[model samples]
Target: MSKVALVTGVGRRIGIAAAIAERLGNDGWDIAFNYWQPYDERMPWGRDAESRAELVRRLDRAGVRSLAVEADLEDAGAAEAIFERVGAELGAVGALVLSHAESVDSGLLDTTVESFDRHFAVNTRASWLLIREFGRRFTGEHGSGRVIALTSDHTVGNLPYGASKGALDRITLAAAHELAQLGITANVINPGPVDTGWMGPELIDTMVGLTPLGRLGTPADVANLAGFLCSPEGGWINGQLLYSNGGAK
Candidate 1:
C-alpha cells in the first residue's frame, strides 16, 4: 500500500485542507481526510455535503486512494476515532495536517465560558491528542512522520481562537523535540491573512496593501509550503514555526 496522509477540516472545496490533501496525493500519498459539516454550516463561508464527496472524486482522479471521515473535533474521543478509521482504511498514516479550527470571533470580555471551552476542545486539546496518537502509531519503516498545523497571528479581538492555536503551536514544537529520534518532524505554518472567502472586499484590499508582496495569500500557497515540509527534503526542518505569508511583516 502507498503511504497515507490524514488531513482534517476539509469540508469545503476552496479550502487549505483540501489543497494540502491534493498536494500530498499528487506526491504519491493516499489521503484520509476528516470534515465536520455542521462546523462549516456555522461559518461565514458555508460548505455543502456535496463538496466533501467531490473532493474524494478529485483525489481519486489524481490516482490516489481517498477516505472521507465525518467527525466533529469538539468531541473528546474524536482524535482516537480519526486515527483508528484512517488506520483501518488506509493502513498507516505517514503525515498529519491539522487545518481544522473553530473560527469564532470575540473579545476577552465578550468571550463566554462555553465558547472558550469549545475552541480549546477543538483547537488545542484535540490537536495535542491527534499528535500524540500519530506519534504512537507512527512507524519509521514506512517513512518519516510529518506533522503540519495551520496557525494564525490574530490575537487581538479573537481572544479564544488565537489563544487556543497558540497552545497548539507550543505543543507541536514540543512534539518536534520529543519525536525527532523516531524520524518525525513537527512544525506549524502561520499563513497570515489568507483570503479563503472570509475576508470582505475592503478587508482584502487593506490586507493587500499591508502585505509586502502586494497580494493576499491563496490556499495553494499554503499547500506548497506544506508539501515541501512533508517531503524528504524537509526532513531536517523540525520544531519551528515557518511563516508563509508573503512577507506580511
Candidate 2:
C-alpha cells in the first residue's frame, strides 16, 4: 500500500491540519497537503508564511516526502485536481483527512446568501467531491484506506460554518458504509474549542471555564486523535462522530 495521506486546510503550522500532517509524517506516511492563502489572509489571525515553511522543513527532516499544494477548495474542480497532482507526486493516497473550513461568524438573520453558499461549497461540496475522487482512485490494500473529517457542533452565532459541518458529518459518515466494499473506515471528529490563534483572551477564558479541563484545547491534542484514527488500530472505529473535547458542555 502507498502510505500517502492527503490533509486539507494546512495553511498554517499552528492549525490542526499541519499538526496532523506532521504526526502522520512521523508515523511513516508521505504527506500531501492542500492550503488556500486567501482564506488565511482574510481570517482574523491572518497568514503565517514562515510557520508553513517551517512545517515543510520539519517534514523533510523527518525523512518523509511532502508536497504542498495551494488550492482554493471553493472551486469545484479543485478536488479532482488535488488528487491528480498528489497521485502524480506522492503515489496513491491511503488516507484522506479533511480539516478545511469556511468560517465567518454571522447570525441566523444576518448570514448572507453568498456566505452560506460559499460555506457549503467549500466545506460540504468540496468534501463530497474529494471523497468521490478518493473512492474512484483508491488502490491501497483492503482495510488500509481511511477517511477522517474534522467537524463542529457549535451553531448558535456561527450559522454557515456549523451548518455546513453538520452536512459534512453526514457525508463523511456515509462513506463508512458506502465505501465498505473498498474496506475504508470513515469517521468524523469534533475537536471542541481548540484556540489555534482564533480566540481572544476573554473568549479563551470563558471556554476554559466551560471545560472541566480548565484549559483551551491545543492543536496537538486534536492531532494525537487524528493520528490514532488513521492508524491500523483505528480501523475498527468507523461511521461514528467522536467528540474529543475535554468534557466541555
Candidate 3:
C-alpha cells in the first residue's frame, strides 16, 4: 500500500526538506507540503507565492498526490490544520518531516525574549504539536511509521537558533523512546550550510572550504538520507541525530 507523508517548509528551494518530499513522492507516497507563504515575502531571501506555485507544479509532474497548504505555523492550530487537510485529502501519514521554522538571525546580545519565543512558536512547538497530534491518529495498521525533523549544526553554537533546535532535538529523542513500542521511529537530520536561501553563495563557498566534501551539501544529499529513514529498511535506526553535513564535524 502507498504511504502518506507530511513535509513542512516545502515550497521554492524547499531546501533539504523539498528533497525529502520529492524523494517520498517518487517512491509512491502521497505528500503534504506546508509552507509559510505569508511570512516568506518579508525576507530578503524569500520565495513568494509564484515561486511556490512552481514547486507544486514540479511535485504534481512527478505523478504523486501532493497538497500545498500556506499556513502560518505559528498560528496556534496550524499543525493540526495541515494534518486535517492531509487526513481529509490523502489517506494516512506514514512519515512526517518537521522542517518548518521562523526566525531572524540575531546575535547573543541582540536577541530578545520575543525573538526566542517567536522561534519556539514555530520551530520548537509546531513540530511537537504536529507529532503529538499525528501520533494520536497514526495506528501502525499498515507498518511502523517514520518521523524526521531537519535540525541544524547551528545547535552546537548554543545561539538562540541552535538552542531552539537543541530543544527540538531532545523532543524527537524522547518521543522516539515513548513511541518505541508503538512503531513510530523519530529522528533528526542536522545538515550543514546548504545553498538554501538562508545561506548565500559566498557562505556556501566558505562552508565548502571547511568541509571535506569540497562542496555545499545539496538537497539531494539530505533527501537520500530522508528516504532511507522513511524506508522499510530503516526501521532499526531510531532516535538518532544524524549529521548529513558533507562530513562537517
Most accurate candidate by lDDT: 2
lDDT of 3 by residue, 1-249 (tens): 567899998656656667778888887788888887666777776655565566567678888788887888777898788888888888778788888767577777778888788888888888889888878788655346888988875643246777788888999988898877668999999887677667767776788788997888888888899998888888788899998887875
Better of 1 and 2 by TM-score: 2
Per-residue lDDT of candidate 1, residues 86-159 (tens digit): 99988888999999999899998999999999999999999999999999998755338899999988889999
Candidate 3 residue spans exceeding 4 A from truth: 155-158
List where candidate 1 sits over 4 angstroms from the true fold: none
The local lDDT score (0 to 100) that residue 69 gets in candidate 3 is 78
Cα error of candidate 3 at position 185, Å: 0.6
In model 3, the number of clashes is 0
**What TM value does model 2 have?**
0.98
The C-alpha local distance difference test score for the whole of candidate 2 amounts to 0.94
Better of 1 and 3 by lDDT: 1
Name the weakest run of 10 consecutive residues (lDDT summed) in model 1. Answer: 136-145
TM-score per candidate, chains pooled? 0.97, 0.98, 0.92
Model 3 Cα shift for residue 89 (angstroms): 1.0
In candidate 3, which residue pairs clash?
none
